[model samples]
Target: MRLKLAFLMSAVLAAGCGWSGADATTESGGGTIEYWLWDSGQQPGYQKCADSFAKQNPGLNVHISQYGWDVYWSKLTAGFIADTAPDVFTDHLAKFAQFVDLGVLRPLDELAPTADINDGDYQEGLAELWKGQDGKRYGSPKDWDTIAMFYNPGALRAAGFSPDDLSDLSWNPRDGGTFEKMIAHLTVDKNGVRGDEPGFDKNNVSQYGLGSDGAGGGGWGQTQWSAFAGSAGWQVTDRNPWGTRFNLDQPAFQDTLTWYFGLARKGYMPSFAEIGGNNPVGPDKQIQSGLAAIALDGSWKISTFQNLTDTSGQKLKVGIAPTPIGPSGKRASMFNGLADSVTSLSKQPDNAAKWVKFMSGEECQNIIGESGIVFPARPSGTEKAIAFNKDKRQLDVTPFTDQVKDKTTFLFPVTTNAADITALLQPRMDAVYIGESPVSSLTTVNDQLNDLFKVAQ
Candidate 1:
């Protein structure tokens, strides 16, 4: 057990941009640590953390910039090549592999206090995700998210079932499964039609049981493919980022893709063709408009959905559950997380490390937790964070909280090209779902990706 634990810790230590000697500079007051983050939702909470941090280190300046997720990564990559990256910035586990290879960010091990930070202080899976290709830790754990099944109570009632019946329903790719039945039952038509009806008229259907917003269709896996792909033991890349090989052509992967599209064909889900384009159809819209009974998404959307007020200002009674299991007998999720890493060219290494440690600490996490903005990356901190949300916000985030246990699975790739491949594949995936071509159309996507990996090799 100790050896396994040690290996896990080593993996965590391996993924990020390690601290550099360039990070060494004395804080003589008036040094600014530019911080870039994606969650505008957490700005209020994180601003509080910043204020507390500023109070603790009066000489340091924190410049926090918030960007939408898509823009943030693009900008960060540009900054890296230009040597203008932030002194300390937020990073995603999925994006870490790419940045680590660029050697633009600093590793956390050099900055972390040996006595305070060890393998056990974090959730091992999250730790592993933050490790870089050189076997060095690039980012320190901040928060983690898992996929959940969010459904509308009203929609379920209309479908002749309640949240309870669907709560524990199991799933597999085969037909006539419990999950399939609930999905079919939850689907309804504007003319009071259900998907199971013979003349269901899928073209004119009013509501669907599941939604896979065309955002993650063709070669893209994060939002759509990654979640379902995991249930079938499909990985975006082998364990090492530098050793990537596309697995999309593999049988396990093809099976998942076929099954996912099958849901669309059966009228149990919204056909990519039905959604009309690649634009995302937000979860709140699906539930509020009575267009979908259930949607697979993250807990981060919980508060947003709860706070959404319609034209009549009515709110839906929604509940969340873990992502369903597959033939492999495991509940899979696309684990996404963020971390704080130092810049290799920072003017003040010591101060930067201090900032990184402070932000990644339980105190900061406790603050983020109370706001119900995100779960802390540390295991102990996460529990307290969830409990805090329950007591302070009167929101039960336990469904997302409990799913982070051994039951959860994450998509980890072996190469920095993972992000590049994902970007190229999304549009093609969108093509597949929109009926632009068949599933085999994605064959070129995998082929090109395999070629990219070979070049990197």
Candidate 2:
């Protein structure tokens, strides 16, 4: 999910043309700081914090900007190249190494002491994720996410299974274990036949057992197949935070990919033609329309899924489940965190740092947590977020938070050439998903990826 880029160049061009427009400035204090984020859902919460921040600091002002995920990254990249990047912006782990290498990010270590920002105040390992290979901090932790299964309880019951039956589902590469069995039982055809039945029609299926956002796994499957691959004892790289060797060609990874894609061939999952064709559907829509029984997604989508309504305007009751245990005798998830980074070319670095510090502070995090949008990076804020979801949204988020408390999550792959690596391997991965190529085809792509890694070094 991190590696997927769906930017529209036309929109980027339009934004670039208006870079010098009035939308770029708003006076506060004695100067203004430009801040950018991609998530529109979190805008209101941060806007409230920004207004409060400006009130307290009479001499400084912060102008917040929101954009779609793809447009946000594209504009940020164009701004960096033009030496007109935002004063401060939210950063992702997938792009962290590249931004650090480009020297577009200011080291937060120097600003932390002056701003009274303590790295220890944040969640464990989160602050560390923002540190560069040179041992300098580039960003401040904002929030974190983990992968989990989202299912409709009514659909499960229709399939003759209860919500309790979903607990502790196990998987394997060879036969898919109990996980595949569950999926097959849940899949139904237009003629009222289940996938597990002998007369079921693969082509005329009315509902899929499982659904994905797109064709499924990409270079980094944070919300896709990473759970399976990680639990099978596979790692994207030999080490993280600066690993040189990639292990996508390993047998464990290949075996997992084979089994994952086989679901498409068996009609338990959407086929590539259905997923990638015109009028393509996403996991959320599929579940809301009763075309899919289950979907694997990130914790950040909890609010969106909970608020979805079907054709008759009935609120869809979504349930959460942890990933199934794999061959390694455990379940796994990608532990990824997002942070805010100041630009190296900012005209007001001091003001920018102040804003970043405040945004990442406990006060603003508490506001964000109370919004029930995501799990804030601060432990206290995280507690408030869990409580908000339970009390207000009535959703159980333990399936996601439990991975962190249980220490069953792995860090997302962190490498300097992540973009290039994703660019090179994505097509091959697409082929695997479409059944045009076998999982072993990744060996050739792996070699290409290692070459790119060498060049990055």
Best by lDDT: 2
Please provide, for model 2 over 84-199, each residue's C-alpha lDDT reduced to its tens digit, 9 standing for 90 to 100.
67888999998988999989998887774324556788777788888899988888898999999999898899998988788889999999999999999999989999999999
lDDT scores for all predictions? 0.71, 0.85
Candidate 1 lDDT, 223-291, residue by residue in tens: 465666787777766654455566667777776777777788777788765565656666667777777
- Tell me the lDDT of candidate 1: 0.71
Top candidate, metric TM-score: 2
> How does residue 407 of candidate 2 score in lDDT?
87
Give the C-alpha lDDT of model 2: 0.85
Candidate 1 colliding pairs, count: 29
State residue 441's C-alpha deviation in candidate 2, in Å: 0.6
> What TM-score, to 2 decimals, does candidate 1 have?
0.86
Name the regions of candidate 2 deviating beyond 4 angstroms.
1-30, 112-117, 215-219, 277-280
- Give RMSD (Å) of candidate 1 vs. truth: 12.9
